[model samples]
Structures are given as structure tokens and as C-alpha cells.
Target: MAKQERAVRTRRLILEAAGAVFDEFGYESTTIAQILARAGVTKGALYFHFASKEELARGVLDQALTLEGILPQESRLQEWVDVGMVLAHRLPAEPLLSASVRLSADRKARDLFGTSWPAWIDFIAGQLAEAKAQGEVLPHVDPGATATLFVGAWTGVEILATAHDESGALEKRIALLYDTFLPGIAVPGALRNLDTSPDRGARVWKLHQAQHHARQEEAAAATA
Candidate 1:
């Protein structure tokens, strides 16, 4: 049991290290040697766990999805939105998720979707359907299409925000999107009393400012 646990831990380390390297250098440029060095594991051990680099890459992607909770299941639409927002905010702190997003943009990574994407989309669609049935969403809304659009919009915004390395801007964009988009689709009175509070927005802005300041301080310290 101890040996199995150790093996699992080692595999997780390799997956995380590989994901970071892949995020930093992309799939074509990343090498197994770099992953092994980062993980501090031997080639034999890596090979024992994964047959090839492709398999390892897939494992890295799978681990990322698991960590991010991207698979669709019994979660609600609001929960999905919240999870996506949290993931976006944490992307800067999570190299594995960043790498997963990068790989997801690749044509070859389509195969991974066979395992991850359907479950996630179906989950989102199910949530939307439930919302409609409960009269929380507008009766005319198409659940599947709305689910697809929501995922696309969120992913696009997240990618752009991450690319600019601007968490503050990202938060603002998301807030704007939620305020403008949700009301249009929500059932009458369902979200009428929603807080839509500026105070919340202000708090998010302040948090971003703090993060920005911390980054600058870290950079200065590195130079000092």
C-alpha cells in the first residue's frame, strides 16, 4: 500500500512538472528530459508509469481537468460560472491549468476532449435545462446552444486575460459580462433583486490592486 501511494505521488509530481513545462514552452518545444529534471524522477520510473511522451501529455491534461473540476456532472450553471471565474483568477497561480488551456487550443488535443469535453458540456447543458425547467431561465432559451456559447465566451475571455497578464482587467470584464448577459436570459423577477452591488466590484478591484503590488514587490526583491 505504501509503495502504491508513493508511486501515485511520484506520478502526480511528474504530471505537474510536465504541465508547467508544457505551459511555459508549449507542446512542440517541451521535452521529456525537462519534465524529468523538474520532477526529479528517473527515466525508468517515468517510462514505467507512461508508455510514451504522448501518454504523459494526456495524463498531464487529465490531471489538470481533475484539479480544475472541469468535468460536468451534477453542478449548477451558477456553480459552473463561479468555478470558471475562480479558475480564471487562479490561472496565473496554476501552471498546469495554463498548459491545459494552451494544449486545448491545439488540433491534436481534440482527442483529449473525447474524454473530458463531452462530460463538461453535458453537465453545463443539464444545468441550463434544469434552470429553464425551474423557470429560472427564460423559456425560449436553448440550453445546449447557451451552454456552448457560455463556455466559448468564458474561455475566450480567460485566454485573453491570461495573455495580457492583467487580472484586474479580467475581473472587470467578467463582471461586466455577468451584469449585461445574465439579466437578458434570466426569467423575469428571477434575478431582479440580484445585488448587482458596486461594493462587490470595488472589493474585486482592490484585490487586483493588491495582487499587482505584490507582483511588483516580488520583482523588485528578485532584482535586489
Candidate 2:
């Protein structure tokens, strides 16, 4: 069990190191040696986890559409909003996610590893579909179209925020995005119930961490 945990931690360290490198230098310019240096792991250990830089990049990209901070909500639309809010809250602090965005935006990296945009779009569409079925969305709202637009808009907002070095204000910007957007697609009743506050993402993430620790404690107790 200790060995497994160590391996997991090592892998996480390598990924984070790779993400920081990839973010600073595009995938084409980044090398294994740089990753090894950043990760402080031997070359063999890095290879054991990832066969090549491409595979490592793909691994990072796979984390792009995460549900980590989002908890189940009464309305799926609210859940969808939480996804964007949590990302806005966490992306600045999370190297892997920020690097994933960088890679997706980098033409060379995107061509080699493919972008996570499509998967994100699909995930959003799925969420919107559920919301529509639950009558949270208006009848005329098209899930796929809405999802595509949201992803594009979110990407633009992220770029602008990063360019301006306004990481601190990103949550407010994202909340405003949902505030302006939800009214167009969401049913009146559902819209009223939705919370798009700037601090919501932080609150949700804190709750998620508390729940996760509780679950871990329960598991440990059960084993004892």
C-alpha cells in the first residue's frame, strides 16, 4: 500500500512538472530532460509512468474536463454553472489544468496531442441535455449549440484574463458570464434558484474537500 501511494505521488509530481514545463515552453520545445529536472525524478521513473512526451501530454489533457469541485445540485444547470465557476477558481492555482489549456491553444501541441476542447464541449452538451430534460432549460435551447458557444466564450474569457494577469478577478468574470448566459437559456424558475456568485466556486471546493476527507476517514475507520 505504501509503495502504491508513493508511485501515485511520484506520478503526480512528474505530471505537475511536465505541465509547468509545457505551459512555459510549447510541447515541441519541451524535452524529457527538462521534465526530469523539474520533476526531480530519474529518467527511468518518468519512463515507467509515461512512455513519451506525447503520452505525458495526453495524460495531462485527460484531466481537462474534470468534475472534482462540483457537487450534485438540485438543478443540472446549476451543476453546469458550477463546472465553469470551479474552473475559474482553480485554474490559476492548478498547474495541470492551466497547462492543458495552454496546450490546447498551442497549434503545434494541439495537432500532435489533439485538443481537449471537443471532449469539454461534449461534456457540457451532456450536462445541458440533462438540464433540458429536467425543464431547467427553455424548450428552444439546443444543448450542442449552447455547449459549443459556452466553451468558446469561456476560452476567450480565460485568454483575456490571463493576458491581463487578472487571475484574481476570474471568478467574478466567470460568474458574470453565467449570469448573462443563463437567462437566455434557463427557465425562469430554474434561473431564480441558480447561484452564480463569485465566491460559490470556493465554497463548493471547500465542501468537496471536507466530504472527501470524511469519506477517507470513514474508510480508514471501517478497515480498523
Candidate 3:
């Protein structure tokens, strides 16, 4: 059990190191040597987990759909809003999510290793579809189409946000995204009820961390 836990930690270290390198330098420019140096792990250990740089890139891309910081909401559209806002809130600090964006836009690496954009789109589409079923969205709103465009807009907005300001501009941009888009899709009642506050992400993250820590403590107590 101890050995397995150690391996998990090592694998995580490698992924984080590789993500930071890839985020800073495009996939084509990154080298195994840099990741090794950053991770402080042996070549054998690195290879054991990720055989190649492409695999490491894939590992990072796979993290694009994490729901870690989102708490369930009464409104599905609100839940979807939380998804984007939470990501924006965490983007400045989370290399895995940011690195995935960097890699996905790199033509060479994108052709070599596919992205998780479709997965994110699908997830959002499902949320919108559920909201529509619950009468929260307009009858004319096409969930799948809106999801595709929404995700695309998010990508473009994030690129602009990072380029313009490093100081909390991301959340505002994300909030703006919903401010502009949600009105067309959501019903009047729902739109009025929805909270697209930029600070929504930070608030959700705090609650999520509190719940997560409580869960850990409960598990530890049970095991003890």
C-alpha cells in the first residue's frame, strides 16, 4: 500500500512538472530532460508512468473536464455557469488546465495528440439539455450547438484574458461570457434567478474545499 501511494505521488509529480513545462513552453519545444529535472524523478520512473511526451500531454489534456470545484446547484444553467466561472477562478493557479489549453492550440502537438474540447462541449451540452428539459431554457435553444459555440467563445476569451491582464481579469471575462450568452438561451424566469457573478467561482471553491476537507477527516476517522 505504501509503495502504491508513493508511485501515485511520483506520477502526480511528473504530470505537474510536465504540465508546467508544457504551459510555459509549447509541446514541441519541451524536452524530456526538462520534465525530468523539474520532477526530480529518474528516467526509468518517468517512462514507467508516461512512455513519451505525447502521453504526458494527453495526461494533461484529460484533466480539462474536472468537476472538483463545482458544487451542485438547483438550476442546471447555474451549475453550468459555475463550471466556467470556477475554471476561470482556478486558471491562474492550475497549470494542468492552462497547459491543456496551450497544448490544444499548438498545431503540431494537436495533430499528434487530440484534445478534450469535445468532451467539455458534450458535458456542457448535457447540462443545457437537462436545463431545457426542466423548462429553464428557451424552447428554441439548441443545447449541442450552443455548447460548441460557448466552449469556443470560452477558449477565445481566456486567450484574450491572459494576454491582457494577469490580475483577476479572467473571472470577469468569464462572467461577461454568460452575461452576453445566457440571456438568449435561458428563460426569463431562470435568467432573472441565475447568478453570474465573477466572485461566484471563488465562493464555490471555498465551499468545495471545506466539504472536501470534511470528507477527508471523516474517512480518516472511519479508517482509524
Say which prediction, candidate 1 or candidate 3, comes out ahead on lDDT: 3
Listed in order, each prediction's TM-score against the native is 0.73, 0.94, 0.94
Identify the runs in model 3 with alpha carbons over 4 angstroms from their true place: none
Candidate 2 lDDT tens digits, 93-123? 9999989999999999888888999989999
Name the candidate that leads on lDDT.
2
lDDT for residue 217 in candidate 2, whole number 0-100? 100
lDDT of each: 0.67, 0.92, 0.90
Which ranges of candidate 1 are over 4 A from the true structure? 67-77, 111-115, 168-172, 193-224
Cα RMSD for predicted model 2: 1.5
Better of 2 and 3 by lDDT: 2
User: What are the per-residue Cα lDDT tens digits for candidate 3 across 96-187?
Assistant: 88888888878887899887788889999999999999999999989999999999999889988888876889999899999999879998
Residue-pair clashes per candidate, as listed? Answer: 0, 0, 0
